[model samples]
Target: MERKRGWDTLLSADTHHNAVGLLAREMRRASSPLYYPIALCLLRLLTREKTSWELPAMAFLVEALDCPDMTEWSDSILEILSRRLWSQCTEMHRLVLRGLVLLSKAPGMADGVRSLTPSLVELLCYTGGELVGMVLSVLINQVQDRDIPISTPTALRLAELLPPLFGYDNIHVQLLSIYLFQKVMELAVDKSKQLLKTHVIYSLLPLFFHWHHENQDVAEASRKALLRAAGLLKRRDLVKLLKTEQPWRFSECLLENDKRRAVEYACQALPYLESPQEPVREAALRFIGIAGRYMRGQRVELQVAINVIEDMTPDSAAVKSLALQTQEILRAVQRPQSSPGSSSLKISSRRCRIGRLLSGAAAGGQRRTYSGNPV
Candidate 1:
């Protein structure tokens, strides 16, 4: 029984290869925490000089991943396990993520993962650039696979992990995080919309607006994350966060150094400004004006502007004009406004009609009239 301090029977080469069956049998026991240490031992074996066992270790992990009780295992143990594996994780990243994806698909896993979510969130903050990107990518895929809702602490944990990642010295991690976060927002459940207001995501503004040291890839990632989060939540508080967080300084930075991303992030916020509070509307319009000016000729930026305008109130001659102009610009790229654009225009016009009727009524009277509005 003389064993290494960090090593256990599950790590023994002979036993570790057989761990899937061992862990599976124990999985059904009442004291589920027992498997936590066992899982950690397997993780350690995988990270150590035990190449002969890689496939079997992965198989073991895959099995544990399938076990219904896996998430109920201890948080400290999982953290230790992930930390040990972080540097040496290699191709295991996909496997671990795939495992988590499978676990998430199990009807009861979220409830279990919920208990250890704080630990999982902490892991997001601990790893280096590449490892963090791998972790987030895995989590995103699993979330998509399981159709996990965004309001859960687990989802927010994943969101909060992205901003700091913008500072990561690696361009690939930054780009990967940006790409995955966009997909995550697009795939998130509609009911989780209100959770988007949480300040965890608000912290990203500084990175989006002021981080001059970052390269285009980092800047692009920051831009995409802000846009995606804004589109999902539609909260003006995000605007205030950017402003109050550092207005004069950020303005100077954007003006002097990196206007492209600032413009992109601002353009993304415009669609959410439809009938917003005066301050929010003012801020959004200001950003759109700046973004629009810079975005004029570039085909991609122009396309984004067109999309923003299409999503806005059609009654505003300003919004309508911008959209119409965008159509003309897009025409040079290909052909005149296509079906998607025309359909959006029709839908936006109807929204504007509803808005005018409400605006014409006294504020309090209109409140009573549309109190039952589903939205």
Candidate 2:
């Protein structure tokens, strides 16, 4: 205990990393009781005054795991964490778990990780949703040993835990899960089958349907994660959820404030949702109105509006003009379809047709009055 206190005090001075490095070196030879103190010290130093000390502290933990004698301490470390899993405060337990994650990156820590998996699962089961999110972050980011790899069962556990964390009660937790899912998508690209089998693909819908989170950070993260999952699953149905909802939500976002950024994301997200369907076309048109007007005749917004109209217009010139304004706003689409050969020249031809029709009607009305006078 006295030695532990001495090392703890040394970590307090923050003069240099040498003491921390020396302590990490000695931890390999230390007994089971000392692991907690040593782990606690390294975790402290990871957040020391100098940000540069972080990687060295992390490396120190990795190296300690490489020591041949460390295996004997694995069971005890797991036991300590397991007991503290429920009783301890969230932050303190998370620190130790973070260290374990860093330590698991080393090849020699395979036994350590295997021994602790059960306890980690227990934490996932019993902790608050945010705590589970923290554990998921560490797992998705740090646990990358091919030998001690993430198993299907473990991934399923993570997927099951995500729904509640991202459901609505905890915003921070939802944001963190979004980030984790993005990472998982990148890492598991080739393992799409296994990833989907684990129900990682289905896990995202709760965030979309259940929580209408409009906060910028959470919304952005959710967007990226859902897009990634959509790509992995290669399912149009999954993509539909985002496609159907995001534009209206974005338009609503534009109305509130920061119309510029809202418009920007709306533009970036549109092509992903494009389809040869009425709902998509109609929604795209609605978004154009919101985004176009919000951007207030910005070139890109105008161009996007023109493109949507070109693709979606009916034959009526008045309706076409309604959908596709040529700065005059009075003209409306009158045609259901424009011929491909004449579409480029159709605008001029359509104007002439309307002009001639009006001219002939006026002439006929005058001739009828003259005929009545002569009789």
Index of the highest-TM-score prediction: 2
Model 1 alpha-carbon drift over 4 Å, by segment: 1-119, 145-147, 183-195, 198-207, 210-221, 232-375
- The sequence of per-residue lDDT tens digits that candidate 2 reaches over residues 1-375 is 245554554556442344554555566457546755565565455434335454345435544543545555555444444444454544445545655665555555556555556566657667764567656655644544342345555555655665455543566766776676555555543444455543653453333322233355665566667666666666554456455544234333433444545455445434422333333333333444444434443555555545645665354443343344322221222233356665657767765654454334323322422222111
Task: Put down candidate 1 lDDT per residue, 1-375, tens digits, no spaces.
Answer: 223222365676655534544454456364467765666577666555557556556655665655544555434324434443443444455445445445545555545444434554576776654556556654554455565555555555555666555445566776666665565566556554456455434544433442222254554455445655654555454444343443222333343344556555555455435632232233343344444334434666656655665666545444344345434433343323346646887656754543443232223222322232211
**Candidate 1: Cα lDDT at 251:** 34
Error of 1 at 64 (Å): 14
Q: Hey, what RMSD does candidate 1 come out at?
A: 16.8
Cα lDDT of candidate 1 equals 0.48
TM-score of each: 0.35, 0.39
The models' CA-based lDDT, in order, is: 0.48, 0.48
> What lDDT score is found at residue 213 in candidate 2?
39
